[model samples]
Target: MIPLLASLLLVTTRPAVSQVILVEKAYEYVQKKEFGKAREAIDLAAANESTALDARTWYLRGYIYKELYKANPATGGELRAAALEYLGKSAQLDTSLAYRKDGQAVTRYLVVTFYNEASGDLNRQAFDKALTGFRNYLQARSGEPPDNAYATALYYAGYTSLLMGNQSGARQYYEQALRLNYRNSSLYSDLTSIYEAAGQDSLAAGTIRAGRQQFPGDTVLRITEINLLLSQKNYRRVEAIVEEYLALYPANVEVMLVAGTVYERISQGDSLSRESYFNKRKEIYRRVLSTYPDNFSANYNLGITLYNRAVDLIKAQQYDLDIVLLYEILEKVSGLFREAKPYVEKAYRLSPGNLNAMRALEGIYYNLNEKEKSRQIRATINEMK
Candidate 1:
């Protein structure tokens, strides 16, 4: 009777001991490289309420799955998630030295995996995925010493978000990197774009100025700043900014182009003296042309500006003028057309088949009494397929 009763007690105790026994068996299976059985054993160990809170159970679970994740990150799926979660939990519980070491190793592998995935996504132009992957790498190794790749990762994270059309996300990630003192010139250039797109004109201007402070010789940011100021109709400030840059970088084609654009914007607005702004825009383009003789934009914009100025001047002449006076006014206006002709002609030479350049040349040649040239320009325009 006593022996039978003892056997019954042992049978009831089996369920109670099942959790740790399964966990130990999981370790055994892992040693034998039988991950399938290891997973089964760990799953059962975690399923039991009594073992659920035990540190060793979670540690063993983490260890088994960490190996699985490291085996193939792309195929890790729920196993990867399970490993990261239980490993994090084990570390949090201060399980043991072995558990902590395994957790760190898993995290290190995760860092490497995510970094590679981020770079791969970047190569494929899968920007949103790249951004997330880069961020995941940082999260994996939060307390580790940052390498040069840290800034590169952050910059790409921002760039990828920008590509995904998430301006706010780009700004957030870029700003984090900037705060960490990342020293790339494009950092400022890109941040300005985000701020400008968001309609934060002041912020955009500030970003450009800040970039200029860090990289004083970078005229791209300087031009962007001047353009932003122009958009706000800050004409004097635009003049000042452009002049400052020109003094520092004499005959710079890009800065000169931006300066011309600034005055062009000012000339179109009512706040400034249109005549002065018009002349300034012309002068700036002329300066650009002197350095870059075959520059298409300078020639085209200068021609357009002269044509518009003549139109404005002619319209301002009153109908009260006598026939001879009107004739004389038309003759004087023909001089403006003459001045604009060579610029439009040069633009046409630079871009042989450009439709806008062709159209502008036709108008200039027609107004200047070169009917044959005008006809030829129109024929070329018509030949465009």
Candidate 2:
């Protein structure tokens, strides 16, 4: 019983006395301006089990570190980070509220220091350093009241993370900033890109949906969600989503373009009713051309749609045996080519170097018996080669 009591007493008293001595040594080193030695002593005291749980020990350690941070003329970040970290610990562990104001002051100083650093680094385009600085500022002020600056800093962290090719980190920072209601519409697009790049299609779609809710009528996200559905080959779902968007924005060029492309894809793929699919494609681009007359894609697509219909009609005539019916079909096929001529010509005029439009124009002019126009288009196409 005597041995056990002595061992327990030694275990209790040794660390207690050591902590007191270490604290005294830390203060002495500070008075001598030996901050490195002071840091060492306080770090050992901080690690000792007896002193580790004591708020007073952490408080003194924090105060000493703060002084060391101030004494250093170097912009070496380690000392300031250590000061804020220890002070935060001291403040958190101090249930009596003692030293709370001092801890708060140290945290504020760290925040301001980092904020200035981040601003300068950003101006210099030192993205990694800027991100770290903003992150440090936010972390120092964590658990404090958040404001606009805090939210903007979070977004900058995510933006830098993205630029540095850290998609997962970018996602985390963006999600946090969004939860705080950071109002940047481009955030959704970039975050969606990150998730989509990682093959997280469901999460990408969900992010677009959430961003749409936060920023109503954002066409980029709407288009993104539609493209996501299209990528999955969920044509019916894509159609439904595209229709929903078109209802909201009837004159939306991008949505119309996507819708036209989707229908054209199905027509070229496995659709049973190719005529109806082609008709849908033609109608969408026609509406787009009516609204945006010089629209390159719409003009080109409408021309191609008409050209394909004419080709289908000619192919049908070859499958027939009746001479009179073949003649009538041939006449209609020529008329279809004539109908396609203007749109293809418009497309080529709007975008002079477009190979597809030139090719279509060459085909239309040749089929319509305009040898000179066809020859000129063929020479231009050869030059492109």
Candidate 3:
């Protein structure tokens, strides 16, 4: 009875456990590499009203979680996230800057996880989650962002926003990337397209021009600029740009074809300049054929141009024209048809199954008064039907 009374008396006199003691115990567990127990101790300290507001307690909690995460990263996503949160809180609450450096140092270890997780979310087409991940990555930079990594994240954020159909959000992110001097050429073109879609033509043009200045050798931007100018009926500017491109890349058959096609379209409406443009188009096609003798497009295009010119002459014959003038025009038309025959025939040979090339040859033969050739081509065309 005396032992029981004495035990009760000792219990009554015992001091309460301190919250700081739990923190110290957590630190001791961490020193022994018993991260799980350290986490439990720190969590208890954090939940106590007395220690929950302490900056050092939060920092210790963050540090302990970080060790747990490092031990087993594959299953430590929650641990990693919690560590970041606690560390950030420590930074905010630590007015004396006592834990700021350590907190930031720990934060740097977790930064790449945010970006990696965000990239995975992007690839999974989970756009909303991906955006949130990127935002977290930016925040996790801990106030000292590496320029290249920072710009890359911003650019992709814009790209993901675009995929989500959030053009306004995309533009904001893209503009930020641009201001940071992000080196990707697509950034300029994308911004220009956005501006154009919003009916901001001046801004679109300015963006494209700025992109061209920054990436002068970029073929995509050059082509994009040419297309924009062409849409504005700015033919002279289009010509100047094309000629400049050709001067730099004379062997670039693709741009040469584009130039010739553009000239052909321009001649369709500008009668006063029709003959000159056609001649220019013919010269470009000739250059292409010179380098690529068996090229189907150049052969077909040159033949068609001559054939159409002959047809145009015939269409212009007036009812009351002088007989000598009429004979001269007929002679000239026959000469043009003869000139078109070999090219059309070669084009037909290059693409033996092309109906258009067969038809063009048929027309050329009929125009040149070659009845036997015309009959043979006509029979082949009928057989295909």
Taking all chains together, each candidate's TM-score versus the true structure is 0.66, 0.57, 0.64
- Write the residue-wise lDDT of candidate 3 on 1-385 in tens digits: 5699899877764422567789899999989999889988999989987788889999999999888888887688899999988998888889999988888788877887778878999999999989987888877773775597888888988999999999999999899989888998989988888888898989999999999999999988888787777777788778888999999999888788879877977888689999999899889989999999899998888888889889999999999999999999999999888888888888999998889889989998888888899999999999999
Stretches of candidate 1 off by over 4 Å are 1-79, 119-124, 134-159, 168-211, 265-296, 320-385
Q: What is the lDDT of candidate 3?
A: 0.87
Q: Which candidate ranks first by TM-score, i.e. highest? A: 1
* Best first by TM-score, ranked: 1, 3, 2
Note the residue pairs that clash in candidate 3.
none
Residue 159 Cα positional deviation in candidate 1, in Å, after optimal superposition: 4.4
RMSD of each: 5.7, 9.6, 7.2
lDDT tens readout by residue for model 2, 201-242: 988888888888878888887777777777778887888888
Clashes found in each candidate (C-alpha, N, C closer than 3 A): 0, 0, 0
Better of 2 and 3 by TM-score: 3
Report the alpha-carbon TM-score of model 1 versus the true structure.
Answer: 0.66
> What is each predicted model's overall lDDT from 0 to 1?
0.82, 0.83, 0.87
List clashing residue pairs in candidate 1. none
Between the candidate structures 2 and 3, which one is better when assessed by lDDT? Answer: 3
For candidate 1, the C-alpha RMSD (Å) to the true structure equals 5.7
